[model samples]
Target: MSNSDLLDKKLCEKLAQSASLTIGHDVLITDSFGYVVASNDPDRVDSLHEASLEVIQSARKIYHDAAAARKFAGTKPGITIPIIIDSIVIGTIGITGAPHEISQYALLIQQLAQIFLDFEKRQRSTTRTDYRKKNLLREIITYDSRSHDEAAICESAYEFGIDLNAARIAVKLEEIEGRHDDASEETRVHQAKIMECLLRHFDHPQDFVCPQNNTGYVVFAFGLRSIQPQQYLEMLQQKCLCVNSECLTVGIRLRIGIGFFSHSVETLRQSYENACFALKSIHAGIRNSTCLYIGDVVLEKIAASLPDGICSEISAQMFGRVMQAKNRKEVLLTIEHWFQQRFNFVQTAQALHIHKSTLVYRFRRIRETCGLDMYDLDKVLAIYLLDIRHKLCGQSDSRTSSIVM
Candidate 1:
């Protein structure tokens, strides 16, 4: 919120409109770029506030008298001051009038804007508990187990009345595919609306939601003690499916990963890791499912859990040479889809939109190239795991605090 682009344009407009009334002067607001974003005078909106740059660069007040205004084009004799929030210059506010006449009003407006922004920051703090919650979630998920951070996290969770003894599952939602023409601010607004609706949908007494940067959201849902683990998981699956459908309606395709139920913050580390591993499997293109459980990931979980260097070594040993062989693309596609279909020839052929004979020929080439066969389950499992590891290596690492990206 302290960033330049995060400045609330509508709030600035309201400030300009409401403040202009007090002094009988045109109040104007400019973004960090010196583009007038809001003004009491409708025609002045979106125009360049020439003095904004000077004030912003100086991080101090800039005043232009009538004589200086007469010498400069598109100039108004006024006082412009930078709006600094959290020590970052987000934008500026200006009072358009005679420099001497509006000087007092300029100081008053600056103070008023600062007070308003401070109030807004506090509102976000207490209203949604957003600032505090985001920081806590980051700390809990990113810190090492058995560390001082865990004690702090527990204390903070206690303050929020989150039941540490109760079972809680961490669910992560990421927009895997989508396209939109919305500007940054509009996108932020829409995302906020989506989160609000999701918070309501995932409505449990102890459920807590915090957005992960702008790319995704992490939810820690509780109140699972009343239901069996399987039943609770089923209920969560349905909720995530519904949420995914709603997101699709707005041109967002999402992948949701549900972690295991855990009680303590120390174990929550595994839960968050489980969620990331599940998402990595989805991104690995082994399955087309919108939602996956960490427990159901099977060999993928075992394989993806390996260190990146080991995963790379296994992938290079298993399919790397095969992928570099002749007709590699067809072979790679055939082998991947073949395993995805559980070695069903017809299903693999249909998935690849190729004839059964072509698929057979591709398999023959794969066997010849890699000395591997689907009949050998050990080799096949290795390939399956290595393929997932290989694909995950190319995509973003879900483990390194994906919440921030």
Candidate 2:
């Protein structure tokens, strides 16, 4: 801990109160620079105490009598004890009275201060370690091997008992309707809770969660034991459902994405990207469903791999006229649902919560506007491919206005 964080005012005041109650004398606490932080004498707070400075500098106790106190600046007759942690002086605790009268309480007050200082130091150390771990995880998942030394990463992973050769999968959790700023305390609390719940579910030493962005977290779960990848994925999906259900009671919902199993740490980045892609592909129509898998969206992933120009051209050629229609968005959404249902008129209508006749009417309008027969396999394939590209590239709104028939 740094000098500024050595002894906070609240802690100092608590210690001062304890000392005053036990020793029956006015007590004061000072920082390393000798600024009084807490004192039984309310007026003495924030005042400079020269005697405490001397005790800190000398690394020894200072006993001042009435005559000696008069010679020192900002001093009263008292016994001042230096507060030490890890063999370094951090602050001072003083019991005000004549040296002879208050000398007996100096050892007790020093011990009490040390106890609080030690606790604070441990807490700070733990917090620092957690931050380092999070930073390391982020680096491993986001940065390329050329940007960081692979050997050093392996060494660090070994220190944490993480096997670099083990199979792992990346799981991402994102908050739905989470528009709060990243720096807000509420967002931080929510992120912490999400991590806490994930850690509770996967309590193995090799499984770890790291914050991905303002609204999401990425979890890496290594196949340490004998669990199969599919089994692990199912377990994670169930855990996500449970977490989402719990959060719903509090008016928050989470969307979870699971990537395919990665064979080694080198491929973890790909897994993380895949997980994020899957999360982004979550359909807004399925509000009750909270989990998605990369394996389930293979066509979308393939579309994402296509060149941007090719995707744009395909989207323009296939959906141009349909997008120019009055109910462009509705038509596009209906087509998307129809493609998702494998062109089953009955199933697509049921999924869209519309009657079969209404669905047929929409399809007839789409055929007329786009000049593509839905019954033809080649035209259906072309439109389906372009629709996949549009959804994966998030070009629904962008292409609607720009593309022409």
Candidate 3:
């Protein structure tokens, strides 16, 4: 680390104050550039001290008596000690008094300065390490490995003790009800506590946790030997519920979404994307639920992977007339409930809280207006698939209307 970064002005002032109080003499602290950064005499601050420059160059302490002090500019009767860290002189500390009276305190002041400098150095090192870890996580989830050398990625993962071949799943956590934006400092503290709890609870050497785009937390957990995805997800769900229950008392709640298992680095990215999609699928109706899995919405997840234009085309062809009707939302809901109940008229009516005859009338209107054969198995499958696509992608009203050209 550079001298300016290691021994900043605020630290220099603190050292000067402590040294002055301990030795009962005025103290002056200078940077490597020979400028006084802190001093008991306020007028000396930011001024050049030529004698301290000579001490820095010689890498040794210089003592001058009252008679010898006249030879150097900005010099007083004192002992100037070089503040050395790791065999390099970073700054100088001078105690203004007779050489015989203040010379004993010179070593004590130098040791104190070295202590703080070492601490600052270590803090910078830790910050760099954290940045590298977060950067690696971001690249693993977003970078295209095909454009880079495969061996290099493997080597990088090895350095971090991450096994690329291990079975792992991505989990995402976010605040429900859109409460993240207005978070206060106290809320951020709770957020950090929640993240720390996750890291400790997982407690696997190969597992990783990091912030995702300042929005929420993401975790990548490597499964143990012979453990299946279902077992891992079940264990994680139980842990999340326990954590959520404890957090509720503190007025913070979280929703968790889990993706499918991935055994390779390439598929890990897809798993993370699936986790994000699952989290986004949560609506107001399911707000009470704390955990969601990608497997629960397989059809919607599959439709999300298809090209948007193709999904839109399929939706327009299958439900254009019904979506364009005066009561489009109601018609869509009825169709969704009918499919969800597996074409059982009584069950569908009960689910929707409507009379059986009313459901029959609605089905007849759908068949006439949309030109869909409800009883044909192939057409029924296509319509159900399109409905899932519409629910996931939220097809616009304008696109649902037939185009006139």
Candidate 4:
């Protein structure tokens, strides 16, 4: 890259301000074209530091004493040093103070600024690579399956050194929402932080992540063949919990949906869809962070896929009286807790904070009103599916409660 390309204004501004703080003087940096690009003194920015141009031409330090400063246009009574990276002068840094007062810092400041420049160059290179990887991910995952070319996708994956042959787990993340406009600097900063945290946390060779448009990311992680799916999911669940904890420190509640492990690009797409379904399975009313496995959301996905007309017919046939019951909310809550506690009367009662007799009374009333055997597996399953449907659609009789089951 050219010397001007190395002059990142923000990086320059930050380094200038930091160095100024350390040395107790104003710092200024210029591009290769010898124009001031950043300065601790805002007024000096974009002003040509003619002395820096002299340092640039000589490729050596130039001291400007009071009389010398008067000769060069835009000169300050300090030292101007060329910032060299890889033996080439890319820019100039000028310390604004009397030459004798700050002369001791001339070499020290140039070395420090050059180090910062070298680090920034490496950082920018890494950022560009990450940007390419995310762009590739968005291309593969967001396109319609029919419209996407599998061959081209595989080729692009190979270019990025991604192994489509190895098994992988797809994860969808939703960390924040409605807090800032998607295009705002705040949103970008938060997204970058979360992505950086995830990349560090899942530092496996095969793990990759991409930020989604609005509020989240799509992550693909290497799948270990040594562990059972459930065991691996539990491990991933713990890792995601750690991520959530970190995000919470920043007031971000992270929600993640994990898909099952699978092989191949086609299966990868399916896994992505499963992750999406897992995300949808969550009740929007839940404000706390959560990480849900795809397998756990099968019933909810099935319920969600059902046509509205079918759901309506089933809802009417299954719980016509219960829907219109005077105590609809109570009955619904009771049913949900009973099923969640695995039909253990005492446990369910304890969960609901009601006496065992009172819990039985609710179940009895449910059976009578719904006109179905509450103990029957088919009847109970129907209720569960409809409950899931209601949750996914955000349809509720009262203010929606968190979907705990």
Candidate 5:
């Protein structure tokens, strides 16, 4: 039965008479959240059944005191005897007759309170464990489709006391071709043991580590001192190679996605994207035993990492031209051709499928109309930056349709 159900006024009555206490003789029983579940006192029965600050305040204070005394986490509910339950004490049994009557029953009231509290604690522990399991599973599912970089999620977990920062390597585990459907739970356990052994070299009980997905899995781990992402990738690949033995092609190929520190979930999402991209690029033509960062895969970092001043100036000039151009296509084609040529026209024509002569004609027209050099480095950079800005700004034309008089 529930804690409230167990708190019987009849039991309190019997206890009170047995101990012969005259101290008010009121008994109250309260829930963990401080709602009065049952009580013998009439005045407190109605409003006390609802939650109140007075009840929560008293309950929390008592629980904290018990905790500071080094009591086990699950022991708080039963520790405070005969003080208050729900809100009104269900078993106060105070002595109204004499001081001796009240004193005699004090110990009995205290013991009963402790017993009830202990039972409440056991109930809470069971509930919490169930909740945690569900939450863990939910988080796993949420991340299943995410890129392998999980630093952001791990950082968030750490903020909540989950401690995910250790040297980490991501492991991609696919089931053996023929055995995937038939893989047993025992096989999963064995794999877990293998991973556990790998971690045993560095993991502490407080460390965060786990496998996600089916028996075939991907897991990340952290250790005291982190190895470079590539080294960690190699280590995982080597271990998987050993596990596969001679059947190399049939065994699951391990691709480890490595990520650095991320302080928040947004950064973690970026990392995950990078890792997945790296995996795709690395596996495509160059399946070497090396760690690949997302930035390195397509040289995205280098291309996108324009100097701030250059980027800003380019943006301004491109937009300015776009705003001024009579024909949007003229501006766009000019910019596209300029970059395609590397600011040179002779090469740009061949790339754009236009005649070189036509390209020269366009370049001359662009310079005349926009008052910028087709050969200038700054002008070229401006065209490239503006193109991107125009696209992002969702403008059909970078220039105005009508020129102001």
Candidate 6:
């Protein structure tokens, strides 16, 4: 029943006897605000309108004193007891014709108020618990599912009392060249320490943290200024080091996908895609422990547009031939000149400060090993694609390692 509806017929009848003691005397149940929520007598019920205002003014003082005293004094005469739920005073109840004997009944009324407040508090608490459970489940599904549904996301937000229009980000941790079990355990301990420390800096920082799977997910909702990605990344790296020096390696090795600031979860895929690309681009001789931001990769926009599968294929083909050459660096230097000269033998030799005959001998050897002549248009196209891949994706200093670039 609603709070107003809870004024039982039996309760009202019992209270009415005290209200009708003398003619013109009426029972008034003013809330903590002194407003008459219900009355036994119609004539005196009208007084509640003004009384309620007075009750509210008085309830604040009474509540304050009670807090200081650490006991419920109950609102005194000319005052009303407040019906509070979850630390909030909803309303007050007052008795207009209560006698000196009724003053003892003040405890009884306060006890009754406590019961109602406790019930409301429990109900609201349960509601909030259910809401968080549902939200967490929905986030899991959204993180895994490839498809995006605007309607479903919005509906979930409505049910959870989340503002769908607010900006949010998804963070994930992926382990590379490491065992999943150990990686999972380590990330849990590490992230817990990191979050605990960082939250102390923010006014209010709370996140929906998914467990430490091989790739764990964390969603944070906050203002843009609260998290500057670059600064946060640097700070996180330092914090991870404090957790353990090994954490620095783990942090560097882990692929972190940061979703764009978005209201719609669908667009988040773009961020994940970028992170994956950056992770896989790692070659052995490159900077081992570096944080790759999607924005930095985007700054070299044309680099990302290369045809899929072509770069790896070209690298593989060129690597095989480069390894067989008598002078690997010299061969690469020749190819570099060839590329610079637009594949013109005479021009390439001139650029390299070498004779045309010597360039021809080098080209002949390259043609023998690679099978396809570099002079041919189709082969030249493939070679060009390979060169582009090496410059954009592969590291130049990586040739000595297991990774050939």
Best by lDDT: 4
Q: Candidate 2 lDDT, tens digit per residue, 73-156?
A: 778888888898888888888788977778777897889789987897787787777787777787777657667777777677
1-405 in candidate 1: lDDT tens per residue? 435554567878889999998889988888887778889988888888777887788899888888866665555888888988777777899888877678878877887787787677666667567777887788878867655556678888777777655688888887664234434875686577669768888787688788776667888878466788889889988888888888778776788888888888766767877887788778777667879988888767676567766655555666566545656556556667777788888998999998999878877767887676756767676666665655666545343211111
TM-scores for every predicted model:
0.63, 0.76, 0.72, 0.72, 0.31, 0.37
**How close is each model in CA RMSD to the real structure?**
12.0, 5.0, 5.3, 5.7, 17.5, 15.7
For candidate 2, the 10 contiguous residues with the lowest summed lDDT are 396-405
Best by TM-score: 2
Report the candidate with higher TM-score, 3 versus 6.
3
Candidate 1 has a TM-score of: 0.63
Candidate 6 per-residue lDDT, tens place, 130-187, comes to: 4675465455345544565666665665564554445544444444544555656665
- Alpha-carbon runs more than 4 Å astray in model 4: 9-80, 86-88, 93-105, 115-130, 151-161, 176-197, 210-215, 228-230, 245-252, 284-289, 341-347, 396-405
Winner on lDDT (2 vs 6): 2
Q: CA lDDT, every prediction?
A: 0.75, 0.76, 0.74, 0.78, 0.46, 0.48
Where does the lowest 10-residue lDDT sum fall in candidate 3? 396-405
Ranking under lDDT, best-scoring first? 4, 2, 1, 3, 6, 5
Q: 5 or 6, which is superior by lDDT?
A: 6
Tens-digit lDDT string for candidate 3 (244-306)? 676666676777778888887788888888887777666422222577788876866665566
Residue 339 error, candidate 6, Å: 14
What digit string (tens of lDDT, one per residue) describes model 4 on residues 30-99? Answer: 9887889988899988888888787888899988888998987777788889999888889999898987
- By the TM-score metric, which is better: model 2 or model 5? 2
Superposed by TM-score, candidate 5 places the C-alpha of residue 57 at a distance from the truth, in angstroms, of: 31
Between prediction 2 and prediction 4, the one with superior TM-score is 2
